[model samples]
Target chain A: MDRRDFIRTAAGTGAVLAARPGAFVRDLYAFQETANLSHVEARYYIKLPDREIECQLCPRKCRLGDKERGYCGVRENDGGTYYTLVYGKACARNIDPVEKKPFFHVLPGTAALSIASAGCNVNCKFCQNWEISQVRAEQVTAYDFPPRDVAAAAEANRCPSIAYTYSEPTVFYEYMFDTAVEARRRNIRSLVVTGGLINPEPLEALTKVVDAIKIDLKAFTQAFYKDYVRGDLAPVLEAIKLVARQKIWLEIVYLVIPTLNDEPEEVRKMARWILKEVGPGVPLHFTRFTPMYLIKNLPPTPLSTLRSLRKIALDEGLQYVYTGNIPGDEGENTWCPTCRTLLIRRNGFAVEENAIKGGACPSCRNPVPGIWA
Target chain B: MTESLVVIVRGRGVRSRGGEIAPAVLARIYERGLGLLTGQTGAEEALRTLFAPSDKVGIKINAIAGRELTSPPAVTLPFAGLFSRIGIADRNVVIWDRTNRELRAAGYALNADGPGPRILGTDTAGVGYDAEPFVHRNIASRISAVLTDRVTASVSFAILKDHGLAGVTAGMKNYFGAIHNPNKYHDDHCDPFVAELFDAPPVRTRHRLTVLDALVVQCHRGPAFHAAWAAPAESLIFGTDPVAVDAAGWRLVERLRKEKGLPTLAEEGRPPLYLQTAERLGLGRAAEADIRLLEDEV
Candidate 1:
């Protein structure tokens, strides 16, 4: 009981078991006290010549040396100056539900705030957050929460967005690019999430300050990104064609995993390579694999394999295909590829009804592409 | 299929005009390299043929290159004082690594139980890492609860360098500091994730010996500490075939990078192909006709 009094008695017994209602409360103050961490100075790296450096922000350009550390153990190179020890050091904040970052066309049943920090340039043996993405910002227990206090804790938790998310926000890319330029100076919205390994000039400068990135992809063979995602499906299909030629909002997910990446011709060649590279209104999802970390003897995914891989990414035309983690399955909803009309419904990460009036499909007004208001 | 002996030794003046380390010529070069890697002429009968005075041991080391290339407290407290000369207890011999601020930035002196042998780290206080993750093939991690629940005989003791990515970070990549992700096995060049993390079962069922600390051999842009390819090489390699003491510390860091002309971790492409994938996973003998080597000096 001395890691700062076990994180101040597990953050005062997680604020008195987060106000008691079902009370099993265990964020044991998200553990941290691994000597506080955060060293800062990191950004697309370089410095080489003896004390060594390299990093160029992902695609594993690592190169480090003087006290090395970059297969994203939250960056470090120290004597040659690379740094980023989980910059604003959050480790795992919360709020959730931008459809549980199943963005399902962003801003649906909003909330976000998410956060995260440790590390992860891809080690995904089904890492449902490998205790903070396969660890090493001194093996977790963070909480400084910088970047303008993560945009003032997403405007004091009324949170219109600000996710960066559960772990691999591109190895805390300078604390998610300065908490997406301080949650875009107040009107919130920053999203991100990631696994699209990165580095196309820092993911084209994080698609000019985040807003909706997502990208899990996780398997469309390079032999399942070299046997179970140590990483490299061509830099996550060039970070989903650099976040669909940026102006933000791009989704993806995948998960599947039953006999490792639930094949069906690798989900119809990853839905015909995300319908010929990030097109066909990119929403995707599929999601369902439940066997936690290092993939516990495969079992969870099979609600008819996420409805036969969401009918092969919606019969390979891919107009926003869905189906994640099975919650009352009508493949989770969001229809009207042109008047099929359910236009956003969802149940698990709860949205329950949207209807899409102006962003279109109010019974066939047609348009539907994202950030719906 | 038989070979694997190794040994090396050297020691000579064992460094002193202030560079320090001469704990009696590094304890007669770790008692003549554990009496020639255990043929036994008494370094406490070659550590009672690898410990059993109610075992416990540990020693681990390689303090992440801090005080000019780590593993120093006069070379790992005279090899943790040969495990209290075999009856193992100055509190059951610990030593460790993976922070006590890198064993107090390599000069050491932390001693968890207020005694002689315990020099702490695995982050100390209720020692860390190992709340699961032991996995193996393509190695999942979390080890270092001081090598899975405080030693039952281990040793590694690393520090022979030139690694700019495992072409030569000796003694089986020094058990990548006994787990907790050695930067996710420095990809490919740390091949077979440093021989599947020394054939994992927490360092292959509690290792036994290996030693290395090739006295200041950084040999060129190494696991950091450059000082002009830092080469004193007062040696000390030994082995219990942890891939023939890191393939004789990668042929003494390619003979001090071919005496400075450099270029040959396979002509600079990062050649510790995890010692032929730790000898195709049998976990020993990385070529040179399967290692018999030996040497000496002290």
Candidate 2:
């Protein structure tokens, strides 16, 4: 749909337009005035000679000249110092169910104060939220929601967690990091939903502040990452390993596109890799893909493809393999991997029943790996 | 087999001893350059050969680097004034960039309307990017309404600079300002994206001419202005063939880089390979042999 139609529909639905469900819509017509951008100094960049700076935040270590922005289009180098133009400028904010972030293992069915800024490090061809993610900071409307305000909003909204989502959180690293720190002070958890294109130093530092991270592993092969995602699979794999090694909770979501990344063999290889590196206890979501952005030529992924991929991961010894986007399906529920007992039953984003007690299956007393209250 | 004409006109006293542009001399350089490139005797006739009297002309400039390296008013205004000589109304011509902030930083006054040769940026309210993306091969970007809806014809009046990614930012790369997401195209030396972006319908159809402002060429460490590496070429390169004009500008930057004892853009592994790709796409001539370069002094 065109932007005007999208805006009209977004205004009408309010919650459906966002990445997460139950997300309240703000003033969709308030496109930011061109001059309305933040000038906060950025971190993780080294100043070079001739008023240039090298951004070390993502795998694309963009070495930029003065007044030049990085690939993310949010961070810029201004006369030897780098600054983020999106700091405290949230383009999208909503109160969503934590299940929408699909963090099945972390405080499921609770509300997460989700936030996003404009810009992303990688250019995924089929990005669902490309309206906010693909554009630069100046292209989108943003609100002046600072870190303390975000924490306060979460607490005021009675949300137990705050989520950095919609766009790639790595591009808006400072805002997410500071907000996570502020949320921690308020005893609210912070969750990160990312493409996992971040550097090791920043990802490690991020794990210290956040409660859990859901990394969208787009595909298995480097070729797919290169051609379709415009990123590297190696770094995302490295990030997964690093995040799993940390004290924080981790989950993986693989968006299976039809005829592009839906080979059973590739999915099998990825399942085996995750089983070997991150272990079977970590949840692996095989999400269905809809035609969006530049990939309009392809059809929405078949339900059978998602179910089969989930079976492959499960067959490869993954304990928590789930299928997403097809709500109310039997794959939406969490089953006890040990005794085949239903632990938590879900319909769409809603939690219908919980049979797990004290993080263990109620029937067999098998420890279910999750953050259960 | 068809030869593209690229005119390089050097005005010796275009810049004053204090390093300011002499508008009269710069005007003379533009007249000579356009006259030679279009094969027309008078400046008015030269412009008439390219633009119709009733056409809305958009002069897209490069103002990302601020005033130091942008297409200065001393250079651009006089050129825009020539459109008036050809019977195109002053209000029908606009000199614009990406944002009003960048335009103002480059010393351009904000003139959405009620002005001569209306000067403004794409960020002006009601003049933002098109609601939908202009999708083409390897390119899907929301183009500025200034180019898509307003202008009937366009002139890529760009500044010449050495880019870190694209190797050379010239007339063809100037259109990057017309799109919302230029940062996404800087991969792999901007090879096919730059060519593909220019080949997009919004640009390939409306684009009529290219005029590279080489008055103060940022031959090295640019797209940004590093004074230590900048050179005063005091010349304007003009051509109707966008690819050929940029290829000439790239050659000029390489010459300046060599004189400064800097490594060539190719040796640095960042040549403007997009020119060749553009040529392959039947945009224009890219190779030096295919371009018939005509040099003149004003």
Candidate 3:
């Protein structure tokens, strides 16, 4: 077809032409604006001979030649110098509820300045936000929200914390690290909502500046990680261990897909592992998974599955296991583990009530582990 | 049955030391490759057979490696010019890659909407990656607007080079540039990912030809430019089957490595397993017995 005819047809068939189920290419597509990606020299990388460089930031350890990009697609080796293409390049910016970040333990009802850039190290098959995470820096429309500017925007918008969310924060490590440092200076807290797919050194460094981290532990088995997430499960487990060891408030979320990862045995094993590794006090959220991306063949997770997984975690002696994405469910509320009283009554992205004084349950006077100010 | 006959034409003087392809030699290389592949004596006759008059051709080149190692504009533009000569309009032929920056860095002027076969990248204002991903077997990525919207038929005018992960980056792997997330598939020696990405509809459906510019091959430690490892072996690989074209490119790189006493890709632990997977998927044959390689001195 001719260019004019193609555009006319594309425009004419705009809403009717849906991407057929399991089809690889599309008839109608929308090209995003060019994201103004940065090229600043990156940290946590070593220069090698003949302009080659090795990235030590993540486990991938991408050994790149001059002009080649890493697995993250944001970092490139520029004539023996490694540079990050997403330093302070905020591809997405929004003011979301801290509860939306799902930090129920921390400041419950406050707003968080959430931001992220394009690109992720791992490709999750059930990615709800693949438009941002699964694309290169240049494929999105981005703004120049520098570290200092991010802090300023958060403060200006009355957000208590700056959240490195939407996409994987690990991919935009430099931006997150710098932004966290700047937030610390302004007395604003830093929270990272991630899959915990990170190396130790970077995680250690990130924890030093951030107040809390919510790790989305996808499944219990390495097989699930390989088949579904295209990433290793061990590094994520290691990240959780490191955060738990660092005295950081850590929470784990498991999106219960229908048949793929919602097995009771898997949930039980995961609960036991969490109980052993991070202790019984850590909150574990069994989130309901929606059918999206490559895994659209299955339906959304059933309420029964979420409830069953939650029950397993509670039975495993895990103190604070909850179900998410189900509005107004009792699992959305944070009941005091010791006293069995609602500590933080939550519905959707709002905190309805808080029966806590001095960061402890009012009924039992048990100190709850959170950043409640 | 749709018979896809691929050809590889080797030329002696395609590369000049000043980093420009001698256009005369390049035109001859194209003629020889197309003639043998299409069984037509002339370049126009071969291209006319391959492309319908209504087909708007897109020549996608790999230009991320800069001028030292990229599909030179001299080689690709002349081929785009050939499409026009064979009754395809100049406005209909697009010489494109992922971004205009890489094209400019590799010494090509960026011209998307203007005249003369429209040279540009996917990152142009009206042109960018598709908002939704083209979800294929193992690959899910946002493709370039040029491919999804503008072009009717596509040619992979890619540079042949050694990749740290993929073993060799040639015509088949060149479609990585057509997507937004090529970097994500570089793991596991680019096994399954490379083949899967090509099997994706955006690439496989539109892809009509594969042409590798082997004038300056990055023999070792590449997909990036390392002067010490780069070879001056003046050759170009052409084919209709993307699988066979890349396989020929791999053989050329292996030949260069053996001459340099360097370790083979297997010894280095980065073989292009994607070709084998592609073969299994019935895209094309990756085996040596399946390929009919035609070499010429031009």
- lDDT, residue B71, model 3: 79
lDDT of 1 by residue, A75-135 (tens): 8887899988878877566666888878988779887867777778878787776766777
Residue-level lDDT tens digits of model 3 in A1-373: 3334433433433222233422322211223324476889998999998788999888888998777888877888888999999998876777778888788888888988888887888889998777667766766556677999889878877789989988899989999999999999999999999998888998999899999999999988899999999889999999999999986788888998988898899889889999999999898898888888778899888888888889889998999888999999988888888879888888889888988789999989998888887
Candidate 2 vs 3: which has more DockQ: 2
lDDT tens per residue, model 3, B148-196: 8999899988899999778899888888888878888877788898888
- Write down the TM-score for model 2: 0.95
Instruction: Estimate, for each residue in B202-254, the C-alpha lDDT of model 2 and write its tens digit.
Output: 89999999999888899988888887888989899999999999999999999
The CAPRI classification for model 2 reads as acceptable
How close is every model to the real structure, measured as TM-score? 0.38, 0.95, 0.92
Computed on alpha carbons, the lDDT of every model, listed in order, comes to: 0.79, 0.88, 0.83
Question: Considering only N, C-alpha and C atoms within 3 Å, which residue pairs clash in candidate 3?
Answer: B6-B240
Better of 1 and 3 by TM-score: 3
How would you encode candidate 2's per-residue C-alpha lDDT over A5-32 as one tens digit per residue?
4344334433435433112111221243
Number of colliding residue pairs in model 1: 3
DockQ: which candidate is best?
A: 2
